[model samples]
Target chain A: MAAQTGESASTVLVCGEVRTCLLPTTQALDRRGAAQLLRLRADMYVRVSERPIMHVLSPETLTGVDCRLPASDGSRTRAVGTVIGRAALTEGRLLQTTSYFGLPAVGPDTRRPWGQYLVRPGIVEPFGMLPRKATAAGVLQGARRGELDTGTIAEGLAAQLCRHELLDRRAPFASAPTRLRWVALRTGGDRPAALTNFTLAEDGLRTVKLRLPPDVPASAAAGLCEDLALHDWLLTHVQRMLDDHPFDRADDSRSLAALRPAVTHLLHLWMPRAHVDGALAHLWDTLEAAPGFTRQWQNLVQRIRDQLTLLDLAQCRRAASSKGCEE
Target chain B: MPERVFRESTAEPRTRAVPLAHLSLELGHLYMEDFQLGPKRLGEHFAEVRIWADAVRARAARRVKRPRISTCFLIDDYFTRFSTPDEVIPTVLEEAGRAGLTIDYLARESGCAVADGVALAESVAHRLVESPPPGSYGFRPPASRTGWLTNGSRSPASPPRTDRGRTDWEPPVETAARNHSIFMDVELWSDDKNGQRVWSCSFLAAVWQLARLGLLRHLGEPVLVPREQDVAALPPDWDRLPPLIKVSATKAAFSAYRTCTLVPHHFLPVENAVRLVLDQVDVDTAALAQVAKRSADEGMPVPPEVAQRATYVFYEEPGDPIEDGKH
Candidate 1:
């Protein structure tokens, strides 16, 4: 399959962007509804997993491209190929879509027939030698005018799916969508895939870096990164929920309203590496040990629970005091 | 990695494999005009097709020790509804028989549009990822939405603000041209007077080619499955007929790793457009991989590109007979 094309030794770099947001429907879709929403190709199945959580993955689709490579040093390199994109709905509420492609160091001086490029779905071949460092940096920084921008493709897929008739385009709560830009550089030998850097930049943009082993496909790396992005977005979104409703609010219902959605829709979605391939799953440990994704999530869950408990106790005391005054 | 016991059938999607022939040799395509000319004209078409069909078989034999070859013919029912299948099938068979050419399978052109309740053409249209022109930067509207496919960049609809001084029309340039350009823009489909989408001949031809290559599927199941029916008692209406039928009791399968169509020179432009569509289509990767693996197992690996796997012979059109009063 074309996905294996990225797994080949020829692929020197793989990069992508992931956009995560709440499914805009008033209520989360059930398994059947999620399948209907994500049936991107009528002939293909919407892969549904029920183990850790109900996650539905749409079939991979391609977007053909012929444009200049994004280079930090500003060298103009024209490339031609397709970028692969797919959407996933976790618990039928968290909607995420990713667009990615792999690149070889060099290609034929001329663009081959489009059929040749189609067979290698996610590979964008440069017309000549690749400027690896510059291209990698440029992708992280984002594409300029006339340069390839993966984020657009990712956002496009998400928006297209969000517009499906099955979705009313009304969210249960207001939350900002998060964009994670990631790049994976090929590494030789038996060394395992490693997360080298992860940066939370301004404007809801997060950049991730990884040293990927040769045997690990770019898609697998992409899956791992998507997992990271989904969890990161969850934490960030829930934290924002708490921060928005300050404790000093005269009405406790405002805080309860802010945290209710998190408890209802997000608390159980923190299972990292759940869907990642076993070979690349270990990469999550790097981030887990440092910033501690699960650690922060647990803390948020605790805070939300404690807040709910306090609200319940205050209500009980008021009810008891009112009964005594009536007697 | 440690292994535990947990399984979900829906999560693990599988592609059903189809029986394959080494070469699927197309005899000739039947249109309303060709049939209108009567049996003599059909016989003439077959005679010319037979010459190339034999050559293709001989080439396939040389590639493998034992080549499984199938011959199929297409009838145009979508553009112009003609006589019943019962009335047409016999004449087509008799004409091919006169030329000593056996059509192993027979397919209606409409089958490419929709087969067995699946919107094959629309699904394929969605799969099209147009080749981006230089400086695209993921900003261009996709060709699928525009209902047009092109080999190069279309001339600007008057220049943008960046080119305020330019008033003259600039020529469209082929993205893969070498100092020269042969640009082509094909209308894949159009809306009819009733606002119904009318699939173009070239787009259907491309779908036909994909079916021949065994790269199409419906929910992980093979599509366009050729049904073995009693030709003597075939249906009178075209709608009652299956998309594809096995006409001959031949051992060869309906589809093959490669296809060679014996068509007239008049169809050159449509076939070229078909190539354009095939080049851009992202076929079912699993189906593609199955063909790749099976072909490799037989030591006759198919071409990596779907378009490359299709070959054609653009022969001269058969002479039309003078109209007789015996209509």
Candidate 2:
């Protein structure tokens, strides 16, 4: 295919038929030049042949043998195959190649025997054109080996391939600078997650500022607020547990068992015996009078009772410890 | 008693029509004279006619004792006046004969015996007076004083200024007809609310009652004679009344009144009610369409949530290649 195009270059034989020689822009034939070359080939073929003769031959057939032996030099006969191979290799190196997964080739003076063929691993003598599958595999393998950059791969595949497959896969992970500043504004100084290094004004409002990653779009701030709201509920519940048991010092690790003391302490502060009685009456009244309050009130009452039990146990332990210390 | 009556026999005529200027003087004399004249004058003048009517009614009622009676009449007074008496009366008699035959046929078909036709007619005529025809009792009240005042103030005073209080007053032709109909209605129904008479019969019933009472013979046909201006202003097809005349007329009058009076106070609620009704209807249609669209677009059976939330189904615009790329 490279020889037919009159440019020594690698070529793709699409659907085992038309030869498409791929040359660099500097060496490629312009439209008018290609048309002239096609006309010349037709004239030469018609004038040379008296009788029609067809041969099913591979590009390799053009090398390795000289049929007119006595009429040719013996040295020339030995060098024919090597000479042909060298010429073909030079052409392949000068040209570019492209791959088409399922497209047929088209060009003047091209013949296909079976219309389908597969490529195997090995250097085959350059036919009139390069096989489509072989060329694609070669470029893909080059990329995998880092012999070709992404740009080269893109150029080779540009004519017949889509870029989505290359783009859609996960890129190498890297952290970028944060773009948004987030501030957690709290009312008091004793908050567990407080940032106390900065001084507050006379109004006593404190804000703990944090940065959000650049990858997190501004639109996602709403989602962050929702997540923070859930986190706030959980954090409040945990702190309440820690407050209930004065002796049990727990760390920030959020385990249900560790949270029990805090929950109990908070419940005792929020609801003493008198308060609990009042809450129960209020809950009963609410459930009876307002249908909306029933489920929430039931959950609240259960939570309160559980915390009270834990607090009572903690108090007993403290009382026992005091007595033991006296003894 | 005979000698006392003889002594008073030479008394002067107690009642006489007075000139317009002496109306008050005449009325006072008549009132005193009537009080002294006793029951004899009352019986001879007013009570006698009523007694005669009661005697006729009692006789008719005694002759009929059926649980219910219905009668329809086609009085030919207008036909008699407009056409030859010979031509019109015979046609009416023929129609009445045909009606009687039809009723007999219906009674035979229903396996019922024929009752007295005169008694049925009398009872129906009496009931017709008691219950005024539809579209009778209602009167569109005078147009508001504010509208009259505004129109009066707005218009240039070239013509003699019309009384604002008389904006709704009809011309003599219309007023006379209306007053005559009112008088006949009062005489026919003889309605006494709290022993104070007020005619409340529907227009059609008054016409029917007048025909039954033989008043139409003395008064001529009671053509409705809509005001000339009103007739000119009527909407197209006003001459071709619909079968639901009563309903249509009441609706027209009520709508007019609503526009004049209730619009300011109740406009918002009425508009909201209409909007709400329309919205409910639209929502139902939209929901159905949405369910269908969802089923088609998703390529899955529609879920209940989709059906519940779907407001409308619309064809998606053809996918714009550029927009598809952006997404």
- Which of the numbered candidates is closest to the native, going by highest DockQ? 1
lDDT of 1 by residue, A82-120 (tens): 888889999999999999999999988887888888888
Q: Check candidate 1 and list the clashing pairs.
A: A43-B219
Least lDDT summed over 10 consecutive residues: which range in candidate 1 chain A? A1-10
**What is candidate 1's CA lDDT for residue A140?**
99
- lDDT for A206 (candidate 2): 15
Candidate 1 local lDDT, B51-128, one digit each (tens): 888888788778787888999999999999999999999999998998899989999999999999999999899888
TM-score of chain B of each: 0.94, 0.17
True contacts kept of each: 0.80, 0.00
Task: List the lowest-lDDT window of 10 residues for candidate 2 chain B.
Answer: B20-29
- Which regions of candidate 1 fall more than 4 Å away from where they truly are? B159-166, B320-327
Write down the worst ten-residue block by lDDT for model 1 chain B: B318-327
> What TM-score did chain B of candidate 1 earn?
0.94
